[model samples]
Target: MQEFEEFIQEKMNPTNIFIKICTFLLLCSTLAYGQAGYGATTDSVYGSSLAILSSPTTLPLSPAPAPSPDYEYVNLTGLLTVAGPFSTFLKYLETTKLIETLQAQANDTDEGITLFVPKNNAFSNLKKVSLSNLTSDQLKQLCLFHVLPHYYSLSDFKNISGSGPINTLAGGSYTLNFTDDSGTVHIGSGWTKTVVSSSVHDKDPVAIYEVNQVLLPEAIFGTDIPPPAPTPAPMVAPDIAPVADGPEVADGGKGKGKGKGVAANSSTPSSSYRITGRNAWMWAVIVPLFVGLIVVL
Candidate 1:
């Protein structure tokens, strides 16, 4: 009996040691997982429920939430208060009486909008060509070409790289391209200009992408300018060959027939030599004499 008790203790000791080792391993694993920011639940000896533990550290999330679009109902006049070169464009919009549409809102419902405004210099460049002289419909067409149907933020632009076209209210679309490593935006063929400021006045329910220049659709400017009237196809006078007045028909018949023969003979030129006709001589000789006179006179 004494030997058996000693054997039991020996077995119990190993089992307890194994249990302790397992507990130590489990604790280490929990700590490691917690450090890695994993959530864990542990059961306490006290008759309470499991305790949940969350990692203390958290990763910073990317892509902040988009701004609320609420104030876009304001017209072009209101936009002028917002800084940057857009103010000048707003003035032109007002002068052009485009503010009316921008300010108009539904009777009670609020809606969001996107306005792609060209810079003042863009208008100046356009004005130099006297495009403002174009009819109202044409001017509106020009303005609409700059606008997109949807509100787009700068973050949206980065993904829009490569050859992709977005339809505008302009009755056409503009192609998008990435011009810089930092994702500065450019629109239209060749990606000519950079987006100087993006996501301005976004809370106004309008997304405005302020680029360095006006975005003109390829169609608007791509057409070949008509070749200037092909230089009026030089007026060339037709070259009329002089007639030799071929030998008059001679009738060998004599007496009464002789009269007819003489008449035909009289109509014939006295010689076979070339007679410089009025217009013909002017081109043949007068042109040379005129050159000589130019030097002499």
Candidate 2:
């Protein structure tokens, strides 16, 4: 019996040690959650700010910017302001129907986004083509050739010399050649262009570079916007008429000719839009850690 008791004690010793270590880790995690950094939660006890995990992380996010003001550009003010000199050139994005894709709130991702902007002169050449000659997919391809999968900023490539390939979101890549002349930056590869000025916004979130000359993929010219789709034809119901049981005059002697018909219109209900960007702090980090503790250690 004494040997059995000794064996039981030996087995329980390791269990006690593990519990203490887990307790320590739990305390540290709680402290980390209470931190007041970029993605931290803010309870009054922790003396931090509260926020919804979905919204962008801005420092001192007081008086949140007006939701999508009524300008020509609905949601791309952030992208426009950072791109500096390329500000006017991105107008083609609107004309080419590409702006709708980028400004859409649904496409937030970690892929590095690179935009190769064309100069105004490029558009002048495109205007010569008539719209009737273009296909829907061709216009989409022309605009897509400008976008790259990953984000590359002017500062990231300012010092590098020699030629390298930059891939585009359209499944094509363009070669890049960089030259620095006494502090001025020049970029040339397929098309002639120079970066007049550039700056970074919100840290690594945006890298805007302004350039002279146009960056064409040799595909945009001669292309035109596609025609709008034709409207669908309205549906017609089948005609059904009641048969005359007797002559126009009934056996009762009253003269009858036709019956009155009623027509009713059936319409579908419209859906309402909901307000997003609510500031509710989600406790996503703590829940996972607590669940794992009860499982494999």
Candidate 3:
């Protein structure tokens, strides 16, 4: 029983207990160090992933959209309504339904139309002839007479100038004449002769020119059309009078006066000396003669 107690005491010794406690502490520290190292490694990997996701990268951009074409339908009625004092012409166009025809031609770009619009004063100045007496068909023909089937710019008139009779929109015997005076385009319609005063609109499909006089077709009027008046002669400039030549009196008189004064001054001294010598000789001979006469007495 004493041996058994000694064995129990030895097993429960403080040194053994201390050694076991130290071993347990060492194991716990190692485990803790390993867990801390693992946590640090995990954090480093997660941070690297976040940095890669946050970085910027280059990429190709998409191209820009293309521009649209410039083709547009022209509005003739709206254009004439806004431009010029075309109210009178617009009235005639509406009255004869020629506006629709002109608008249709304007919509077509291939073989376009040319229009000549008269001003408000033009319709008012139709004194000798009267449009009020005309029939509906005659008025339509008159309105059609003002238009050409094909488009013609102010510059194109130069090509058609003196190119015989041009076919108008009226068709048949309805024709007109064109004459270009320098840059001006003159339109002759048998009864009326006028030039294009200004261009209201000149585009590819349509052209509108302003004229002073209303075009009167010979078909509506009789064939007994009056001849065109003669062109007035240009005024001549007055002739300038010729300038007469004159002598340089100032310089010439000054030189002549200077030369005369110099000659007169030069001769005066010599004449005075000769006259004084002759007078002295006469006095000497007269004094000697008086002394000899006194001695003889």
lDDT per residue for candidate 2 within 1-297, as digits (tens), equals: 999999889877988779988999999988876674534433442553334444587677578777863323234545665544444556556666777665542135544355556444545554425323556665556556655555555555554645465545555444445666666657654433556454433233333344444544435442353444589999999898764443222133433444411211112121333233442223365667788997876
Q: Whose lDDT is higher: candidate 1's or candidate 2's?
A: 1
The TM-score that candidate 3 achieves is: 0.53
Arrange candidates by lDDT, highest first: which order? 3, 1, 2
**Runs in model 1 lying further than 4 Å from the true structure:** 1-76, 104-111, 125-128, 173-181, 189-194, 225-297
Model 2 TM-score on a 0 to 1 scale: 0.36
Q: Write the per-residue lDDT of candidate 1 for residues 1-297, one digit (tens) a residue.
A: 999999889878977889989999999999898866532233232223322234355677899899875442444455555645777667656666766665552112255446767677766764324564667776666666665555556666666666356556554444434443476665543323546465456643466666667654445555443333346577899997554333345443333432334445666544654565776867888888889999998
RMSD of 2: 48.6
Residue pairs in clash, model 2 = 42-48, 112-150, 112-151, 113-150, 113-151
Q: Backbone clashes in each candidate structure, one number apiece?
A: 2, 5, 0
Model 1 per-residue lDDT at 178: 47
Model 2 whole-model lDDT (C-alpha atoms): 0.51
Kindly list the per-residue Cα lDDT of model 3 for residues 147-196, writing each as its tens digit: 89998988999999999899988898889899999999999888998999
Q: Quote the positional error of residue 104 for candidate 1 in Å.
A: 4.8
Better of 2 and 3 by lDDT: 3
Please tell me which predicted candidate would have the highest lDDT against the true structure.
3
Q: Please tell me which predicted candidate would have the highest TM-score against the true structure.
A: 3
What's the distance in Å from true for residue 279, model 3?
93
